[model samples]
Target: MPTLLLVRHGRSTANTAGILAGWTPGVDLDDTGRSQAAALVDRLTGVPLAQVVSSPLERCRQTLAPLVEARPELGGPTVDERFGECHYGDWTGRPLSELALDPLWRTVQDHASAAVFPGGESLRALSHRTVAAAREWDEKIAAEHGPEAVWAVCTHGDVVKAVVADALGMHLDHFQRINVEPCSVTAIRYTPQRPFVLRMGDTGDLASLRPRPAHGPTASGDAVIGGDTGDTGTP
Candidate 1:
């Protein structure tokens, strides 16, 4: 079984302002985000990832920079637009609180169904594209690298959740349940018969961490209680 390490990008300026930063350019990680990335690099020192993949966005790219610096032999992570955040379209830079006032926002939050952000891609559309891309990448990795190989995928939180939920055989509606915090790392191990989510939302605890063995019956769970649902991976 190969392990897929899904990492949500570090915090961004828009994140602090409660603004939706979907697919917007020039949103780099803040100082805290840089520290988080450094912490991640240290945590991964023992893990020895075989390869790295990331969204082309600067934030996602920067998140993996420390790893490359630590282990220059690992080279650099590959970028894939398919792994980019959800397209927020017109609502990209709007304040989250204001957007929540829209009725469509309510439908998306309550039903876990596909709801487009006015000028953006629908949830269903994103699910299809992301899943397809992930499958392709998984196959390539399995063929190119051996079974036991782990690859780092740097992406946005919502996108990570979507791919993670689908790969683990969780229901599409379950997307609302998996919460990936900023700079948080979730490790998913996939075997032919089943997939296991060994860890989720562990940023501060990465240090002094032991190798987490895989286990799960796909806990019928959702994101952490009170975590953001705005999907910063938007746009």
Candidate 2:
């Protein structure tokens, strides 16, 4: 098994402005985002991360900076397009408040699998690629670094949420129920059977967010716990 750490990028200028920065270039981390990222170094202090992977977006790269600085052995963070932000197409840089008034917004909130953003991707497609990428990376890491290896992924909120939904085996429509705040850490472990979710939306003090053994079996007969697999409550 290989442990995967999902970290949302620190808050960006667009985040503060309440704008949708989908695949938008030049959106960097704001001052507060920098401070949040700096604090993450201390939060992940004792974690033995083998490698750092990030989305090509500037904010994601910037969020990974402090962690790389703290652990030089982890080397530079690798940019993977699979973990990139959702392409909102026509809504790329629109203000969220205005977009929320659109009829499609409600569908996106309650029925994401059926909601396609203007000329962009559907929530189903986002989950497909992101979850596939995670599985691929998990296999690669498990083979290369062995079962005990831990790694980090710095990406967008939607991507992280999508992956979390897949780990929980939840429908894409229910992804909104999971909250992935800026710079938050969500952990998952790929086992011989299924993915085990250890923690979700942890912003600070990872020492208190340690992973525990899953208690029961999944529908597929694999042991699973956390997220929505065992409990109906949010992780």
Candidate 3:
């Protein structure tokens, strides 16, 4: 089996603005996010990736731009919609504060398995597709690139959380306990016997802040607004 590097996209303007940004058009990386993306090139210098995958979302593309530029042999990231951000429907582009007040907010945080965005997709569906995509890609990569080959998937926070939870054999409802900061690198290795989560939220010496409970219902989870802003407030 192949080792998978799960990377969340860098911070975006929406992140700084406290918006959910789900499937929002024109959402790109902020200055801090660009810096984080560039720094990623140096951080993974030696680990050669067999393939670099990405979500079609602009932010994810921008996050991996520097890396692709540095390693042209990887031939850029192959777009994988299955790894895109969770569709928030009516919740898209809304301020996290207001969204936190919605009744579904509690379900998203406490019982994600039952979460279904209005006019959007369900958390259960998101989990199924993403996990299946991961397994499919992992098997394909191993067969094509060899067992020692490594690869990466540059995607969103929730997707990472979902995949990480599945790899850990934890229920989706308990996935809130797993967090991956923006531009962080999480490594997981799959063996014939089982899958192992080698790392989670491995940002390189990046000083950052995570919102406290007072922030909101998703204060500690991936509904992250202030949590990954790199701002100094409420650390």
Candidate 4:
């Protein structure tokens, strides 16, 4: 099995302003976000990452910049559209407070699988593509670098949540219960039988991702909880 590290892009301009950036072009990581990305270098110090993959968004690219600069051996980060932010359509760039008043908001929070962003995409579709891309990458990495290989995927908060939901065998509607913070790292290992979630939205050392000795203490934790309404303002 190969380990996949899912990293949400650090906080962006929109995040701080409570605006839904969606697929907007000019959104970039704020100063705090830059520091957060830089800090990941030390946290991931010893992990033998095989490669780095990122969503083709400016914020995501900026989030991985420090890692790429620190570890050139990992090769330049490759852009993967499958992990890009969900298209919010009419809701793009709207304020979270305003979207909360929409009747569709409740359905998105409670019945996400059936909720489609006006003029955009369905949460179900987002889950399918994100999970499929992860599986494809997992197989590719395992074949090229062996089952012990580890890689990182830099993308949006919602995308990370979707992947986590699938790995947990949860329904799309239930994905709202997962919370992925800015610059946090979630990890999953894919085996022949099933995918195992090693970590969820961790902002600390990744030493736990390394293989443990038989007698070593095991890593255990609980999942973070929150509701995501598929609104552009979520982080």
lDDT of each: 0.75, 0.85, 0.85, 0.86
Which run of 10 residues does model 3 get worst, by summed lDDT? 206-215
lDDT of model 3, residue 64: 94
Number of clashes in every candidate structure? Answer: 7, 0, 0, 0
Question: TM-score for each prediction?
Answer: 0.84, 0.89, 0.86, 0.90
What tens digits encode model 4's per-residue C-alpha lDDT throughout 1-235? Answer: 6789999999999999999899999899999999999998888887778989999999999999999999988778998899999998999999999999999899999998988999999888899899999999999998999776789999998899999999899988898999999999999977666677878999988876765332222212222246322221211
Pick by lDDT: which candidate is best?
A: 4
Off by over 4 Å in 2: 208-235
TM-score of 1: 0.84
Clashing pairs in 3: none
| Candidate 2 lDDT over residue span 48-153, tens digit each | 7877899999999999998898888888899899999998888889999999999999998999999898899888888999999999998898789876677899
- Candidate 4 clashes: the total is 0
Please give the lDDT score at residue 125 for candidate 3. 91
Native-vs-model 3 lDDT? Answer: 0.85
After superposition, the stretches of candidate 4 with alpha carbons farther than 4 Å from their true spots are 212-235
